[model samples]
Target chain A: MLKLLTFVKNCKEGVLRATPKKPRETRRKKILQTALEILPQRGFDGITLESIADALGYTKPAIYYYFKNKDDLVCSLVTDYLKDAHQAICAITDGNGSPKERLIRIIHFYVDRNCEQRGYFTIDHHLGGVLRKMPHTAEADNLRKLSLEIPSRLIKLINEGIQLGEFRDEDPAVLGSLIFSLLGGVLTHMEMPSLASLGVEGLKQRVCDFALKGIVV
Target chain B: MLKLLTFVKNCKEGVLRATPKKPRETRRKKILQTALEILPQRGFDGITLESIADALGYTKPAIYYYFKNKDDLVCSLVTDYLKDAHQAICAITDGNGSPKERLIRIIHFYVDRNCEQRGYFTIDHHLGGVLRKMPHTAEADNLRKLSLEIPSRLIKLINEGIQLGEFRDEDPAVLGSLIFSLLGGVLTHMEMPSLASLGVEGLKQRVCDFALKGIVV
Candidate 1:
């Protein structure tokens, strides 16, 4: 009984630590990475803290030490995913080349990430409906904001492209929406037998070719 | 007791008619139409036979007479909606004018349908996820086939456009997927405040303009 009490105390203290200790943070990252690896194979409903723990060869309590529950883990995973994607996109937008060049890079960035993280995109698409049904949480709000911000950044870049005569003079908002739509559709249908035969490089080339031609002067 | 037996007899007879009697068929159509009218406003969860009946000044039994239950009603509604859309698209595809003109008509058809029947599209979007989760039914099978057929038709038109040099040389399948993605994305985001301001015609023009520019030779 005393040993059990000590273990419980230790887990609670680990969760409440002001800053996650280094080893604990590493384990947490591993847990999230493993969760993503398993997601596409098993789907959202099939994943659980216990399953993730089992995959990592850790105990369930070890998983819970970092995340309060499954929702906490999933929420953090999505938040981090979006944060990383947003930062990458922003960097491209803020970097060298002209608006058109940056736009092409952004398209490539999206396609590459999507092809590499097929599981994440599948989960993200499913989450679109699920998140709307969920009550507003700080996590959900942050996610919504990040999702909107990424596209808005692209829209701003398109505006710059138009001003510089790199892209046709058109409503940037409309163009951005259409481009994103094309990306979303392609990503959603990537697994279709017909498209799958094109392989990654072929798919990337087609998307970039279609999207760039749609806007470029 | 005799009157109750007669009422049951009449209802069962109404359902069993070999070719639906005019009155019964008209009433069944009314039930389906009213369900659609209520679907967007109330959503799938909020809608029920009772609500649809109340809207149409009929009893729940009047609904059950045509549909076995809520699922039957929804399945029929989806089947009818897709059938109608598929037939209309075929008509346009088979009609006069260049491939470009027909493609534009198809886009217009989609935009116009989506705008006018906002409820249907909303329900359809929600149903995309729902249908996947559902066990396969004949209705589900039909709906799936029709959905694929519509896109296949578009792909064929794109191929014709390329052959005629009306469109640039590219994979018709890839282009078709991209175009559908654009249309799907636009329809999905139609309610966003940013795009809503564009109004229906403005939105239609943008879709056609961007899509045509992408492939036009």
Candidate 2:
């Protein structure tokens, strides 16, 4: 009991010193979360630091402490979300399984992510507009690279599947683009009235079955 | 000599009545053509009556004579473009051919049309924003219906293919959505730096092969 108490006390001291209570980190996260929630409803241009602070019951200065402006806030939001997505992909791809299984897993992962991240994909066109307007910015370049990473990972998985004899021999680049396109369509059209009638599983099944059929040996 | 004169007279009369030299129609077409040309470069919002007039070498009043306002002008442009698309689809689907062959033809036609109509798909997001903002307009409703009609036709073609035993047994509605999504992706991505490298034929082949493989038994 004495040793347990010491250990706990030491842990508390270490956490306090090494990972101090960075309210700014928490504040920044809160700001990003609020912005993301507001993005689909209000759009990138519509979101202001004032709006974010109002949502958080904080002053506009409080948000300024974390972000220089709206553009900065958006850049952080995009880069963070994409980083999380990249991490999710790595988690799925790094696990023990056949390459074919990993590919399907990645597909399902993306579909599920798209559904969960409704505001992300729904505002894709809006995002494209934003990217185009700010093409020379480092943030824009990062966003572009992160977006390309998805298909890049997909191509790698396809190449792995082909080498393992788990899938038909085909051009990974072309196949990857096709798969990416299909998922992009799914992202946009999932909310269409006709497609919405398919329900989520029915919609996912169609994408999965069709994608798998295209390359299944 | 008498027969030739009569034929020439008939031809002149036919041309006079058939086309009627309606300056209004010609002006309307010119405005829409200019708008289509400028939309990608300047976007819908960037376009103004003054710009259209400047492009066509007409006074802004002349444009307003044909189109009551900018919204009216855009509505007409969308409706006219979609009508042309619908006609193109009809010309293909109405022709006598196996369902599979017709499907391939439709795919190529859409790809060809997309390549020819670069600015159209690129501005799709901008158009969506405009449509959402002006939802109650008849032109918006018509545009929505015309857009839906493409996928509806795709479903019909897929159904015919199944009935003809050319395609594997599957849900035509879902399959149609998948195809539409794939095509949408292809359209948007065709000009991406990576995809642009695919060239037009290379991109079309990827879309065609993947789509056919997905449905073909």
Candidate 3:
């Protein structure tokens, strides 16, 4: 009975510790959310650990425990995004479909993701300026590679489409860049009330249709 | 004989003053050119009076004599471009031609100008980030108005096209934005060697074709 009681007490303690750990995870998520909110307005240099902590009703030490500093925090935020984007791109590109279908799906995925993460992109636009200044840093270099990969993946898709004779015989590299540019231009306009009025699906369809007509066989 | 000598001396003085003024004008142009060269690489904050002076082999006070300050220099550069853009837009919008033709001409003008001024757009991209931060400043507000006018002019042209039954019955505002987005996307790509390899006329033709197909009935 004594052995059984000791085992039961240990199990209960483990469960109690697990419960508190989840709240810390929740707090970390909340910190990232608050950081995203401030980034679009103030940019990277403008944000500080204290500002994030103050927004979350926590102390600076509390944030430091979660994120080493602003650089680590921003790296976490950006890498997390890039990971998700890479996964989405892979799923769409690797899926079984015609080149046209795959290309359309890729565009849709980008449009949908941007729409879903509307405010996050505003932060990204601000972060771009910060990144350009520190282009030689490892994190900035990684970001550049990731950004270039997006267009490169599209180029592959376009090349596949061309070989399959689904798309017109245009330079895949140029077309990929053009599509990337189109997506970027539309996303920038999304912040405008007039364009946002088109809503998500409506705008996606328009963009896809425009892109399709440009290169469809 | 005294009257003749006085006339000759006055003519000599006038010629000497004119000769110095020509060099002053040339120097002012050189300063603007050097500033444009540095802007794309360094952004607005990264640039300083000392840096511009260093690039041009002049003293800061010399630069100050040409431009009151950094803000004055940038304002002058941007306003000069805007002034030229405004005049070109007005000529295209008000000139006699089919709405479709006028629109294509405008797109070509923009593409050509951007291709011709490739490095300049890089500076513009950086300036955009700076403007976003101080969006309510007088210069920023003026830039906002000028930017809006570009799209607004397109909307008018599209409206006329729809009335003439040249374009499909779509929202003129939406179509204008779409064209604007397409133009923006293509202009950005003009700087990349891969895209610039498409050459000015080739890239302009592709942009025109894509835009025309999107709206043509």
Candidate 4:
């Protein structure tokens, strides 16, 4: 426990120290953080780098030092979020267990990660139509590409299960896409009458059960 | 052949003449037809009575003769769309085919319906805010209700299949939601990059193969 606590304290110090360590880097991080937080509140069409800089108590040039433009800042936020998701999904999948157990844990982590970062959905995902001619356009495309990879890995598990005759045959690529839907279906109810009618735990179970039912031998 | 040809002409004439036949009613149908054509290009925010009227060579008051207000018009659209969807889904589900086949056909219809009516997804769909305190919000709320009903119906199908010993024992509701995701997964690829990769016919076949692989006996 002492060692774990020591390690955590060091980690926190490393993260804090990593920030504001360099003048240009600090401004970049600040700009990206501001974009990540504010994009959800105002739709993408309404956001400007000037507004983001003003919100952070910085000059436009200060932000320009960190990001080339508004889309660049958004691309960075999207990229960072994708990297975090990829790492989380990878950690869950790397564990040694039956695919069923692994997937349950992954689904649980997936939902928790979503709730933990619900703000990103509103910010980075509104309309999802970033303007062309931005330098980070390729990177933004890659972030979405990364988003697709997590499900691909999950589908790979289902494919393996089928090969072992422990699960029924299913198209893994399509199965991966469906898992994404099950994962996000509750968002469909956000505007409905009962906000709390279908709880998160219940929604997750629905996804897990849906996945297993189609495949169990 | 003569009788069949007459039946076809009669059906077409009936659709055209089933209208309220009132001069005022023509304005309403004209408005809705215009809205369907233009709204997808411009989103909910992009539509207004004046714009629709301009497109139809009428004045705002002329359009209002049919709809009370913008809200009334939207509610009418929602009601009409849902009625059509319910009818389309019901036709497949009325004991005409096997459970697996019915599920596939219905799921295909749901996905295809969206492709044809991309207007529903053009905006953020923030109805919680849109419907708040509005008198006609019930129409939009019903759309939300249908989201749940859709999965519930699928669960019923899975339960029937399992009881008939066609599928393995698994939770039905969960499976139903999964089936939704399998089809719902198409939303992620609406933009040009992904959209171009998935040509129209390519997606239809993908949905078919995906559904059968998951549920085939």
What TM-score, computed on C-alpha atoms, does each candidate reach? 0.79, 0.79, 0.80, 0.60
lDDT of 1: 0.81
Q: Which one wins on TM-score?
A: 3
Candidate 3 CAPRI assessment class: acceptable
- The residue ranges of model 2 lying beyond 4 angstroms of the native Cα positions read A1-23, A50-62, A122-148, B1-24, B50-62, B122-147
Q: How many backbone clashes does candidate 3 have?
A: 0
- Sort by lDDT, best first: 1, 3, 2, 4
What is the C-alpha lDDT profile of model 4 across A150-217, one tens digit per residue?
66777777787668777656555555555555455544433222323446776566556655654566
Q: Pick by DockQ: which candidate is best?
A: 1
Question: Candidate 3, which segments miss by more than 4 Å at Cα?
Answer: A1-21, A122-148, B1-23, B122-147
For every candidate, what is the interface RMSD in angstroms? 1.4, 1.5, 1.3, 4.7
Name every residue pair that clashes in candidate 4.
A210-B174
Give the clashing residue pairs of candidate 3, or none: none
Candidate 1 chain A least-lDDT 10 residues: A126-135
Write one digit per residue (lDDT tens) for candidate 4, span B47-158.
8888899999988887887789887877666556656766776676665767777877876676676677665543224333444434645656676665445456667777
Which 10 successive residues of model 3 chain B have the least lDDT summed? B126-135
Chain A TM-scores in order: 0.81, 0.76, 0.80, 0.69
